[model samples]
Target chain A: MRSVRYTPPLWRQWNLVWNFAQRDLKSKFKGSALGWAWSLIVPLATLGIYTVVFSFIFRAEPPDLGNGRDGVFVLFLFAGLTAWTFLASSINGGISGLIGTGALLKKIYFPPYAPVLGAVVAVGVQSLIELGLFLSVLLVLGNVGWSWLLVPVWAAVFTTFTVSLAVIFAVLNVTMRDLAHLVTIALQLLFYATPIIYPLTLVPEHWHSVPLRVLIEWTPFSQFIQVFRGLTYGLDAGSWMSWLTMVAWAALALGIAALVVRRRGGDLGEEL
Target chain B: MSEPAIRVEDLSKVFRLHTERRSSLKEIVVRGRSRRAGSFQALEGVSFEVPRGTTVGLIGHNGSGKSTLLKILAGVYRPTSGGVVVDGRVSALLELGAGFHGELTGRENIYLNGSILGMSRREIESSIQEIIAFAGIGEFIDSPVKVYSSGMYVRLGFAIAVTLDPEILIVDEIIAVGDEEFQRKCFDHLFRLRNQGTTIVLVTHSMGLAAELCDTAVWLDHGHVRAIGPAPEVISEYLGAVNENEALSNDEPGMIRAGLDAVRSGSGEVQVRAVEALDQLGRPLPVVLTNEPLTLRVHFDVKVPVRDVTIGIGFIHENGTGIGGSNTREHGVPIQLEPGVGYIDYTTDRLDLMPANWRMSTAVRSHGHVYDMLEKAFPLPVRSSGGSTEGGAVRIHGRWGAAVQEDSPSTAPSAATP
Candidate 1:
């Protein structure tokens, strides 16, 4: 006998995913006076604090814009913070997506990935707004280039990477309640490790026996930040090595996420 | 013939009862795989088939696996063993507004909930007007659903679900919402859908509703299939078992006569031997028809001689509300009792009860000295003899009339006043 399972094609289910995303976007800023401004205000505030501590207090120098123009420390910091904030928020939001909808899951059956993907898209929209404002600022500064056209490419890559990790963590968080806290702490440490606040040159070439600079350069988050910075702020194409690392990381994470969701997604109703 | 809409083969579901609710990484690491307290078999080897274009009811008490079985069919819960094949699109209203976001407006929730039920944007847009009209919450459609009254919330949820025109619909006790008028509207819509050949699976505690709406019924007890057949037969058997269980649990002389199908509680001095609804010809009536003459015959055994005895019989609606009752004392009639078996007959020319299931409660008392009381002593399945559109518990035979009189100058009151 044929089994009673209805799994519509992923493309057909896009409307459901969009609906979930719309819910996330609207409810996120539902009752605030500032509304969508808070999305920008939050990262901007973080930018302000880091600019004070690192650029002014610690006297850190930023890299040049590569277009015969001097680099402003705040603009340099905002470019990297844009990428970092999107990754952090999307992953964090994705982790709670399944748990928050546990009540709905217990009563109805839909694709479990819809809510998590919706959350990622919601954060992606906020990140897009931040990117638009940052690009406009760069345009005003006359830092535009052909490399700037590659921003969307890097964005698609960045989103894939972010969604993969989000799906993974979100599914894990359903069974392990403490995983969210652990992820929060890990993201905090990752923020400082990615050189978003300080320049990449601040890291020492070597620390005793370890190649500290090379290790940080090869990290997925560091490479993603470098590629985003190159396409927009630097006006230069990222190196092939960085592009390869980003793709490889995204592909690996996507594979694992697909496997995890397939194995555990069907039984989530009982778990919730 | 076409294939059955739903077919279940030896379905079962077992839930692991977590002793400590250990759902954390730390607890799992410390306690390992042996942390399972025990396993509860929620359903076991239950099987049934519902033909296409027919409605089936799952009837059982709480924790009898009815909800679990419905959830399994709805795809919310998977069976631990066996398989079920359901044809066509399925929409499950397991809980009204289950997908609604509190902060989203009613209009927005329609799109969200509709899509969750597998409706396209065009489908939702096309039926949106009908859904809003059915819900009857006009201006509130634009307001956030959190501000809606609970009745409005349920109405909107039900409206969206039914308007989608799903080929197979699964509902669990959601029709018991809203006021009487709204409930009537919902039933009208459901009947319309059923007429259009939509396969429906309903889980309800209302045996009256089950008898009215379902063509077949599956009675489950403690995760096992007790009976499955025509709706009324299965329902009667289920109710009989329920009353029998109630009779067993209560501590009274009722326990001595344990096989009685009704709940008996009182002193053993006098026992109710049997209670039957009879027709005018003195034959046992299987079911009482509304607006027809009927008689209730109560057989009693007077083991000890008693005086000034009053025998009473009351009719109660299936929903547990007492309709109307009368007794010998109220009618100024006293029975002279002795040690012997006797019977009493309560007859009426017309039974004014509406078309629904009613229960009879019989008792024998004397000056507050209770002899015996039988709760839900007899099942009075009152059915309509024809297509009657009347509503409410009792059918009132009233008439409406209109008359017009010719204008007359001499007979006018104004001429007399002048």
Candidate 2:
């Protein structure tokens, strides 16, 4: 009861988040016939459709790797989609995490951020499974490259931005439920606006649109996808400026989110 | 001598009461201008210290902020202005099984709930078997908790909480659920924990439990600490205040005041307007001692004249045990009824009764038919007059004596003492 800043110890906090993640994952597929196979089904189906449409029907040529493999547009698209799926689902999960667990939070007290962390962790694990499949296919085709080592680094940066946005959206959705729906729509918009499905080079050279270009360049999510692509397919190793911009954007989002949660976290129960 | 386990200084909590819930952005924007209706102050400037290794009871009526105070002590709510200092690991069961995820197995929830209550993984591992045993749901421990019954859920939750072995435990009527055996187990476990130097703060409505279990008691009324002292004294003061309030409300306008009559239900053919208990000297008394002469007067209004109407009066103890009674017809006294206000008195020379609160009732009948009955008219408190210590619903009047007689030949003494 003393006016002290009390928090559970670090290991225990991690355990709590992990326990919740396990519970969420288990319950997600508890009554299903195929169980965890469902996590792989959607992404794989998307990959199959994109491969048939972009490669066969459209006859769009993938960028030349200059190594052995040249025109596998599906592999390149899958690399970027893996990271996007991880970040997108994490952001979406993080946004609804607090509101989803509002019943438990109102009844008892634990660290408010644990649920957001748990949601991120659960989605992260699913994303890893997808990434493993992507890497296995790349290895089977004998196209393994040195640049793939940077996947973890890009993942670290991506997780930072995901956590910040998750915390922000999770807090907002507790008071404003419509924000959850808004965030889902916004994530869909962001997926298309960023260079996940199409290459950044597809932008016309003669276009002088400042806002559109800045949105593509300055957005943390855009940089995350670019960083992931640079590491996986070895097409674009972003310069120091792009790296700094991405790091700055992540730091800014995290700083703002921490401030918001600190100011509004105590009333989470009452608001609910 | 040591520092108290918890010291709360002027603790208060104010809650913003919105006239309508505003969970959406549209509501906030549309009705944003005229929002300042009012707020409710759940607790206001309440202060009490709980010493180490002692059980403190919080007694109050509903909506009296007892649960709010406990939540504040458990750090669930931040006080509006005041502060509290607690000196040990604190665990609170504010809502039983608050952390249980229904999708998880009972065993899994034990670990999850244990960590939520501030236990480490290793600590939960060590106590896992004990917790499972205490829960008593043997195979169901492996099954998801969503399938558990309400009793099983409460039992599992109480078992996990009590086995946490925290230095300080705060409970809010968590044992009020579950079956009687499980409730007894929880109470016994809490009592053992208190004996082992674990400071406990309990919020309960049962004054009997508070007086029997707690070392100190705090009575909360309207968000204020009304009284704080020994358990018996505080409980008595709380019960007295409650009774006084009930009596005042019963005497309010439009509420007919009839003697200990809590239930006024009938066809209303003959209405007993007012009932009173008086002494043999014609003095109305609310309370009388055992073996004291008393009279019960039933005042009624009859709609039509009736003949051979019998008036019966009976005494019932507070524990719902009925004592002996008599009616006018049984005593061969015939009574006539008329359409006017009238009174009938049943008198006793010496009221042989136990030391307890008794309720008096009256009935009107004619020719072995009851016209109307007034059940529980008025309460008469009967106190013992320093005699036998025997316990029962009735007091017996008798004398003890010893008589000697000649022993039979078969029963002659055989052994001798040196």
For this target, which candidate reaches the highest lDDT against the unseen true structure?
Answer: 1
- Candidate 2 lDDT tens digits, B27-73: 77887734756888989999999999999999889999998888777
DockQ of 2: 0.47
Query: What local distance difference test score does each model get?
Result: 0.84, 0.77
Provide the lDDT at A5 for model 2: 26
The regions of model 2 sitting more than 4 angstroms off are A56-59, A66-68, A206-215, A235-238, B30-34, B252-296, B300-341, B344-418
Per-residue lDDT of candidate 2, residues A118-183 (tens digit): 899999889999888887876777666666766776678778888888888888888788888888
Minimal lDDT window, size 10, model 1 chain A: A1-10
Residue A268, candidate 1: Cα error in Å is: 1.3
For A112-230, candidate 1 gives per-residue lDDT tens digits of 88899889888888888889999999888898899987888888888889999999999878878889998999999988888788777889988997988888778899999988898
